[model samples]
Structure formats: structure tokens, C-alpha cells
Target: MSYEADVCIVGAGPGGALLGYLLAKKGLSVILLEQNAELGKAFRGEHLNEEGEAVLKSHNLFEAIEAHGLLRMEKLEYFNNGQLFKTIVADPTVGHLGIHVPQAHLLKVILDKTHQFPHFTCMLNTKVTQLATDESGRYVGVVASKDGISIEIASQLIIGADGRYSTIRKQSHIDMAKRKHGFDLLWAKIPAPKGWEPAIKMALIGDKQLSLFAQTNGFIQIGWNIEQGSFSELRKQAFTPFIQQLTKAFPDLTEIVVQHIQSWRDFVLLDVFSSHCDSWGTEGLVLLGDAVHTMTPTGAFGLNSALKDADCLASLLSKETIAQFDVQVFQQMREPDINEVLTKQIEKEQTFAANFLETAS
Candidate 1:
């Protein structure tokens, strides 16, 4: 093997970067690939749930994120047509009000930290062309491309953290169950009001409608749900009017649409998933993050779910030399939690989207 590593991880997203960092920390050689020329700058879940916080703390990345400015939630307000119905006060005992940090910035820090390790190698502008395995069908390495040259990188194991639309998952021959629900979330970053802070806000419309607002780095995340087919028309409209309509729908967010919304693409997220693979392991190859399971964006556990995969994968790989880790154990241990949380997110988003569709009809 010209270039051999302990683990070859695909994707440089949060899950991949965080996982790479942990693998390197364990004194294992790891190589990570990001197909994009640069990090993604799209609007994603900026809020971190309590479960996610545990993963960061375990990896000693909590303080690094907290220092970037974390806004604690004092309360999560639910409203109906602007009238407050109920409130869930932040319970510090139960990890109420997790950290608020943008995905791009958070992943950047993780990438930078991973590079600090001698055994970690992260390649940007590289795409995985083919995943190679030995004659016995045990996973080995990959065939990737950079600058139009096909380069082969061998590894003791291969990890797929490539996310929902993963090419690696397809190449791995994992029998995945994919369910395309009827709803999709519209994700966007709305600027806070002139004097308001960015916290968690759940505004419910009286016509059986629901909308979400969470804050990160002083910006509120707005996710509106709609039928899966509505995005094409929605994308053609200007964002300001859409946001203005959204502000009108909920009084909790009056004048909060000041977040420099010059275009609609800035607030677009047309995806819904209730998907999982039959297994996450195949000899020296394993699937992690959205590559293995799809999560709905409920209370900010999307990226963290992937990070947890990284954590467990590192643990499994570490024990491989001393004892052959049963990858099936890892799969069984993680699938339930991932599926449970993923179902919650999908259901919530679907409920909201259903209401919106009802109103629109």
C-alpha cells in the first residue's frame, strides 16, 4: 500500500471531522476526504442537543465550542396564533438549552484540530471513486481522485460518514431501507430582532401549524415545513416575502426577519428521511453518521448522531487488535437510538408540514 492508514473516512462534514479527530487522538492513522473544494456554508442545525453535548465533552471538544459563544436557553416557548400556551423552562439538570453554534464554524474548528495530529490526514477537493476490498471480501482501502488523477489509498478499515446521499453507502452494498415521507423542512437563519436574544422559540399557528426557531451565535434558525413538492415553487420566490409571511404567522418572531435574506436559496432545505441500513458493518468496512442512518432535525441531534458513530467506531477499532470487535454489536447498539431519534425528528417535521399543506389547500 503506497498510502496506508488505520481508517479511511469519507466526507468532511461534522460527523467525519469529529470522528477523524477522535481516531487520530487514539494514535491511529486516519485519512478523511471532502469532495467539496471548501467547507459547506449551508444552513443546518445550529443547536446542539444535550445528547450531542455528551459526545463533545467525551472528546474534550466542549470547551472549544463553548468558547465560540454558547447561548443557554432560559425557556422554550410554545404559542398558538401569537398567544402563549405553554412553556418549557430550561432545566439545567436535564441538559436544557444546549449550545448554539453554526455548522460551518463548528466543523472548521474540528478540521483544524484534526490536522494538528500527526496521524491524521484530511484531503479536500477529493472524491471517492471506488471502494476496494481484498479477495476475501474484507474491506481494504479506496480509489479516490484529486486533480484528475486516480490515487489509491489503502487502509486497515474504511468508514463511510458521507451523509444521507452517500455514494460510499451504495458502493458498500448495504441493504438500506429508505422511506421518502411527504414532508420537507425549509431551513434558514433569521437575524434576531434589534434588542432580542436568540433562544429556542416554538410558535404554533392556530390552524394546526408549527414552526421552529433556535439560536446559534446570535442568529435564530427558522425551519418551516412544507410538502415535498413545494420547494420548486418556493425556490423561485424572494426570501424576504416568505420570511415576512412567516413572521406574520407567529407573533413570537415579530421583526426577526432582519437576517440579510436577499435570496431564497439561503433559506432552503428540501429533505425528509426515515431511512436506515440493514447493517453498518462489513468486515473492515463500516458505515457511520447519515451514511448509515437518516435523522430528522428535531432538537439538534443530527450531526451529533454522526459524531457518536465516530466515537463508537474509534472504540471498536481500538479493540480490534486485542479482540476482534463484533461489528454487529456496534450496529445493534447504535441502530435503536438512531432510529428512535430519527423517527421523532421526521414525525415532528411531518406533522408541521401536514399542517402547512392543510392550510395551503
Candidate 2:
């Protein structure tokens, strides 16, 4: 099959979807493809910093998102050994602040809004298999597979918004900067028991044994950050003992775990920084989102950075000001934020690690 569009964005995640939404709003023909069979998966990145919120507002998505019953967590709380450790209030006068909202829900809101434009098309269950470029090594189009059929979509540009393990970035042979910390994270949620305030994002740490993050749905989005291979050892001890460990770490938090602990999961944290050739476009190809730079979520900046990318791309495409807007504008606009995002993430990871080591040990 063959199709033509002004912009073909791969991966219908936050970045691709939002950028597609903005570009299409400008009447630039855009086609979006996602490998997922459906939306609403448990996406890991979930916070929307105040900067991210402001960007959404500027793009006319803030109100719609807020209306979706997103959790308005007024403070970001970090526990040292529990005991109401510290709080980063949503007072912008001091700095930036964001709240907790499932990233998938946010994406749905943007996609729904972007759909209002006739130029926008989101192809679900579609996978971009190959990048087609001209003789000059310029990206020209993409070949994707949907169901039993192979479809080729040619556009003025191809944008990759896939996640951390980006197939597009790997396939393009672009150099990627990667850092791995042997530390990993285990995440889960438990129902909130009586007297649990479920209104704020609460983190409790204890004896270097467990960490908990409280969620809004009368439950806590709990994570147990441990040494890379240590989780398996801990899991072997059974959930009851595991919850006990959390209680031991923050004795005050014991009540919640004893009553509200429901379940949990483990994950390895990674920090990735990468970019395409100086030519984000050989002819018409580009990269966006984690496909470009997968930042370790520290200050809850992954979504914010992605929004920054989408906003810049939207601004460029919407204006179409430079006549020939290609790789240069893309790189120039993206570099600073990408760097800032990476630098900021690394710093946070380090800080979290140090704090954990100190408190837990």
C-alpha cells in the first residue's frame, strides 16, 4: 500500500501524538503510527511538572487535561526515613511544580484534540519497519506493516517518537549516549486505608529496604529501589515480608503497608542521550521523544522535556517560517532542552542514589 502525507510520525506516544496534533492543527498533512494494539497501557513516566502544564496550556490542552480529573498533587514529598521529610510545594514563585496524571490519559486527551484537524491520522497497530531515504542519504519516507499488509507512507518528513528502547534510533545507526546505574526500581500500587490522605505524592524510605509513592486513587504507587540484582532475592521472601521491610524503613508508614499494600513490580532505571545525524533529515526524516533522548525520570522531567520538543516542533511546523524547515531547526531547537533534560536527570539520579544510600544504610 502507498500513502502520502506532509509529515509521517512514528510511535503515537506523547511526543509524536502531541507534535502531530500541533502540526496538523496548522493544516500540515500528518500521519501518525503506533505499534501498540491499543492505547491506555501503564506508561512509566507519569508526572506533569508545572512547566509541562504551562506548555499544555499554551497549546490549549491544559484545561482539557485538568478537566479529565487529573490529580492536583499540591506538593512533591520526599521521605528520608519517613516522618514528613520535606515538601516541594506548587508555589511557582519559588520554582516549577507538576502533578501526577497517567501519561496515557494525557496522550489520549492530546490525540483527541489533534483529531479535530482533518489533516491528522493516527494508525494504531501499525509498525514502522524501515526508513526510506534518497540518494543524498536524506530521509524521505517510511515503510510500515499493518496486519497482513505492508504499507509505505511517504511524507515530507518522518518523525520517531518511540520510547527508550527506540527501534528507529537503533535502525538509523545514530550514535547514542547511554549510562546505566546498577540500581533499579520496583513499582506498584496499594489501596489506601482509613485516614490515608491520598491527595499528595508521598515518598517514604526506610532502612534502605523499601520506598513508597502514594497515588491519588486511594492507593499508593509504591516502588522499592534496590541494587540491580537484589530485588529477586527480596521477592523470594514473599510480599508480606516485603511489606514488613517497608514498614521497618518507615515505621510510621507501617500502618499504610499493613492495611493498604496490594501489589508491586520491578524495573531497571536507565539514562539515555542520543541524536540523529547533523541532518535530522537526509531528505525528510526526523526523531522525537525518547527516541531522541531517554532521560531518567528524576525531577519528573521526561514528559516536560518531550512537551518541550513537541512545542518547538509545533512552533516550527505551524509557522513553516523558514521555508525549508528541516534538520537544522529541529536540532537547534532541541539541543538545549535535550541537554538540560539529560543533565538534570543525571543529577537527580545521583542525588536519589546518594540519599537512598545514606538513609537506607
Flag clash pairs in model 2. 49-98, 50-97, 138-282, 138-283, 139-282, 139-283, 139-284, 192-218, 206-249, 208-360
What TM-score quantifies how close candidate 1 is to the native fold? Answer: 0.86
| Leading candidate by lDDT | 1
Residues 240-279 of candidate 2 have per-residue lDDT tens digits of 7666656655666576566655444333333323333333
How would you encode candidate 1's per-residue C-alpha lDDT over 1-361 as one tens digit per residue? Answer: 2577888888888888887887787788889988887786655566677777888888777788777657666677665445555666878696566667677767867877876788888888888999888899887889999767788899887888888888888998888898776667777666666555444666543332345555654566666666667788866776667666566656545644554555665666658765788888688777888788877666567777887777776776662461355678889878888878877776675464343332242
lDDT of 2: 0.68
Residue runs of model 2 more than 4 Å from their true location after superposition: 78-82, 92-96, 198-211, 229-241, 250-282, 318-323, 353-361
How many steric overlaps does candidate 2 have?
Answer: 10
The TM-scores of all predictions, comma-separated, are: 0.86, 0.84
Tell me how far the alpha carbon of residue 132 in candidate 1 is from the true structure, in angstroms, after superposition.
1.3
63 Cα displacement, candidate 2 (Å)? 0.6
Alpha carbon lDDT at 319, candidate 2 = 38
